[model samples]
Target: MIKHIGVVGAGQMGAGIALVAVQSGFETSIFEPSKQAQEKTKAYFQKKLPPHQPLFVTQLDALSNCDLLIEAIPEQEALKIKLFQELDSIAKPEAILASNTSSISITKLAAATKNPERVMGMHFMNPVPVMKLVELIRGLQTSDKTYHAVKATAEKMDKTTTTSKDIPGFIANRILMPMINEAFHALQEGLASAEDIDTTLKLGANHPMGPLTLADFIGLDTCVAILEIMDKKPCALLQQYVNAGWLGKKTGRGVFSYV
Candidate 1:
């Protein structure tokens, strides 16, 4: 029943989700305040999914009619809460509001909305078009009806679904982030060269990409943010890299140089 989908934030994740939603035959709209980001998304769609694109809107009110609104903003809790509060007042009473947060608490986000039952988490993997998994999280007050509707919507978009409780880091990041952290720890200890470490994991452990490379792909800053939210001890090396503003591929440098 989610015929109209709206996406907030025109970053890689948001634009990717909007692409999938529209390709799946849903009426999709994307709301982004930044014209630069909007242009980037437009260019991305033209290259990756020509002939189909979501409506780009500058105002939040344009999403008021969306049957489902997915927030894919940065990984900041305060920013997300503030956006949800505003969305709660603008969206239709029955519309569902979902967050694409990787490690934040769905229940806490739901609390910002007036109708908690319609607030849930729909954590789509990065590069939404390629990733098959979509983690569906039920907030403390999220209703079964809302969960099912969102699950169906995910299926319509051809994504496999997994359910998670309202936990910090949820399932994916709870396990993944720690492993990435250990990768940094190993690097700091001089246990192996970054290349050898990545090679060992790729050939030995059979991981698609080495942990350090994956961290870069996910954004080192984002990795740190998720770890901080999970209350994990800081890894000095990771902090130093983040401090240098080498936020992985986006910034052209991270644990390794992308330039």
Candidate 2:
């Protein structure tokens, strides 16, 4: 059994993963350089997790001793490469390196690391507790040991794991983004207000949230990033929303106002 888990980045995914790891008996540490991020992540854990859970650290070097270091940093290739390069030097030869990337190329990331055999992708959906599915991506050089280890970790987290080849948008988001883009198209066409669009989806389509609202939750910047990578044009209204700095609940405005 893996005894130690390290997570880089103290954002939503990293914090949630840390909470679940510690709750499952793994000694977990979250490494974030930014002080505010460190405190915010710890505060999140303090509120939602047990008081006796594992600690959080402020240096990436702290992850060297971990059995598994999961990188939940930004989706940019250069950033991931830089972090992986440092992690490769610090981590043990047998330690697994995992990426929480949504759409980046796993093979490229693996190749950037010293041990491609030990690198794999672990894509956890948003609202980690509520989302049950995780996508496990294997690079061309990923070894069986690394793949199975991450799969086992997800299982221990009580998450359903689906194996997928690295592709733009991975799996779910590949299909979901087009739908969200369509919703914006419909709204721009004057078929409905954002409220009406969402209502139609939740009531008529049996979804928990409407596409516009879901896009907001996903972050407009993230949506545009994914769309641009997928070679899909951003719906005009969304382009405008992104231009205006109304990024969503995180920014207090989007398809709907936070207040």
Candidate 3:
């Protein structure tokens, strides 16, 4: 039933999700307030997407017709709540609202909107076009109807879906982030070099990428943010990297320099 999809925030995740939606034949629109981000997204789609382009809008009103609107904004709770409130007012009454938050509370986010039952978390992994898993989270008031509809839509986009109860970090990050943190601890302790640590995991544990590399790909700032949300203190080395603004591949630096 989700014939039209709208995404807020034209960042990497937003652009990737918008590309997937349009590639799967949904009429997609992306809303980004910043002209720089809009231009970046347009350039990305020009190279990756086919001739047709998803509507890129500078206003929230353009999302009025979207059957489902996925918010891929930053991980700030206040910002998300404000956007949800605005979306609830601007989008169609029947539109399903979803957040791509990795650590924030779905229940709290849903509370911002009058129609809490229609709000849920659709936490798509980074590099959305390639990531196979989409963690679907149900808020306290999220309806079964909303859950199933979003699950079906995710399947239509060729993604594997897993339902997770509304909890801090949910299933994926709850387990993954801790391990990545431990890896940082090991490195900080001088137990092994970053290369050896990652190589050990890649060859010894069969992980496709080492924890440090994965941390870079996920963005060290994001890892730190999620750790903070879970009430888990990030390792000192991780905090140091974040403080240095070496956020990861996006910034050309992180655990290891991309340049």
Q: Per-residue CA lDDT of candidate 1, range 1-259, in tens? A: 7899999997878988999998899999999888888988998888886456689988999899999999999999999999999999999999999999998888998998879999999999988999999999999999999999999999999999999998889999999999999999999999999888898999999999999999998898889999999999758999999999998987889978888
**Pairs of residues clashing in candidate 2:** none
10 residues in a row with least lDDT, candidate 1: 45-54
Model 3, 221-247: lDDT tens digits are 889989999999999999999899999
Query: Tens digits of per-residue lDDT for model 2 on 1-259?
Result: 5689999996767887888788777888888877887888878877985645666776678788899998988667789988888999999999999998878888888888878899999998887777889999998999998888899999998999998888888888799999999998999999988899899999998999999999888778778877877889989888899899988776789988887
TM-score per candidate, in order?
Answer: 0.97, 0.94, 0.97
The reply for model 2, stretches above 4 Å from the true place, is: none
| TM-score, predicted candidate 2 vs. hidden true structure | 0.94
Better of 2 and 3 by TM-score: 3
Candidate 3: what lDDT?
0.93
lDDT scores of the candidates, listed in order: 0.92, 0.85, 0.93
lDDT, candidate 3, at 18: 93
Q: RMSD of each candidate?
A: 1.1, 1.6, 1.1
Total clashes for model 3: 0
